[model samples]
Target: MDFRRTSTALTREQKLAVVSVADVKAQERITNSYEDALIGQYIEAAYDYLAGPDGWLGRCCLLEETFEAYIPNPGGGFELPIRPVVDLSSITGFEVSDGAGGYDPVSAALYAKSVNEGFGYILHSGQSSWPISIGVDPRRYKVTFKAGFGAADDVPSPIKLGIIMLASHFYQNREATFSDNRITAVSRQIEFGLRNLCGRYRISRDHS
Candidate 1:
């Protein structure tokens, strides 16, 4: 093995680092299916919904903002973060719910609309890098509710399942025939951009 030669294989240090990150991500993807607890069932439902051509699991269908992540997805990178945009000015229905920390079924419904609006911002806004810049774009989420009973229960079991299943993709290892230079270049960019944000969250560019 020529250590100095720039072959397709990763160097010893590079491979180890990538493997470590990949392992952590893989653990997250593991679905606890012993008694079909919090994760297993949810993932199954997502797969079921995605079984058909119109399952609405692809990039355009469900996700509105997807560029840097999907455009040049990195190694051990399957778990994708999708943000949709919803216009506060247009939403005409129930009160808007903000799931900043967390959310239940009802909150998820309203938040989903808001996320779609963010997606629209990404699609049109060409000033920034891609999805992240757009997703972070300042937008308002409306909360409208009439004096009535607990908001309509649109939180179906199938939807929950899909969410779980969609998350599973993150654990799976990706195989690329030809490694692209962009992966390394993008990681460098990530490292540079996140230098200031490091103390808060651990961010590094170790794409092998």
Candidate 2:
């Protein structure tokens, strides 16, 4: 299966920012608002670094987001690529009818989702199997779903704290490796602390 993000919390005001600008300011002990914009960028960068498929954790963060997963050929069911899936919006099976691509929506009654821990799996409701694709299309089946830990309040404290610390680090260090003509390494303590805080939530995947 392959996954692509279709929408994000940024699209909705209420779902934006797992950690706010004020949160980062407080973490860095900033008492003014002069660098609020830059701090906000760092906050977003920290979030991108720790969340999503390419993130360190390889998982969704707080707030709801939509993703689309494509399956070449489905069996009785398949796992949704993103973790902590909140809802399966729709599943559509693709076909080549009259030499043209066609999409048929699977009935909600014919399937169900099973969420355990943060993993999500879609299963056929009964003994039936999923419809087969007619051709060799790579994206034969499309699954749209919402995934995340939920609202800001539902996010774990460790993850939130980790973001704050990471953003603060970015705020203090403008360069990736050098400052004042001298090489600088990222703080090992902060790196280890982030790993410790987010390690349990990291998703290990063997597939591309």
Candidate 3:
């Protein structure tokens, strides 16, 4: 099984557009410069929650990273081919360790047909169990995979809407929500609206 660490595909400018912030020119001293900066932060926050680690809004991205599959239950056998993975698109590197401090690359053809759309990969080596030790450390079973919609431009509309709505709401209401002088909760209506829009993007193992 494989797990991954992903990077955000949205840029500050693209995020600003999502939240409907006024674009600032190179040397323009906009009156709401401070607000603009805050808007960027809010966008970051929205994206972080929506598409960060375990986030469900699977935006498309390039092959940015690969990670070791830290399988927690090697004793459980081959029940889990991919470990709590994000939206995996393709595998770039698949290597197994000999448990004697040597590594061998697994052929792509072996696992190519095992990828399911929403589920993770399946290992089919005509064997009942997967290799338990892919590395000397037993935790370095590794496969580099790609995931996301394809690129930032290809982010799903629902996800983009969620980011815009959340960022705008938070920016407009930041004062009361986080101000030292006037700490207050977000209104129920606003809370409900944001939840309805953004909560669907949350990844839940219980009901996913």
Score each candidate by Cα lDDT: 0.27, 0.70, 0.50
Q: For model 1, what is the alpha-carbon lDDT of residue 78?
A: 22
In model 3, which runs have C-alpha deviations exceeding 4 angstroms?
A: 1-34, 54-68, 72-89, 100-102, 107-113, 125-137, 176-187
Q: 131, model 1: CA deviation in Å?
A: 19
Clashing pairs in 3: 1-81, 59-149, 60-148, 60-149, 60-150, 97-134
| Model 1 vs. true fold: TM | 0.18
Q: Per-residue alpha-carbon lDDT of model 3 for 126-163, expressed as tens digits? A: 43445564324634455555554444555556667766
- Candidate 1 stretches greater than 4 Å from native: 1-34, 37-56, 60-83, 87-118, 122-158, 161-208
Which is superior by TM-score, 2 or 3?
2
Top lDDT prediction, candidate number: 2
lDDT, model 2, position 169: 82
For model 1, give the 10-residue run with minimal summed lDDT. Answer: 143-152
lDDT of 2 by residue, 143-194 (tens): 6777787777888888888888888888887886444444433666666888
* Count of steric clashes across candidates, in order: 21, 0, 6
Give lDDT tens digits, candidate 1, residues 45-119.
Answer: 343343211234322122111122212211121222222223433222222123363212223322222323223
TM-score ranking from best candidate downward: 2, 3, 1
Sort by lDDT, best first.
Answer: 2, 3, 1
Q: What TM-score would each prediction reach against the true structure?
A: 0.18, 0.80, 0.62
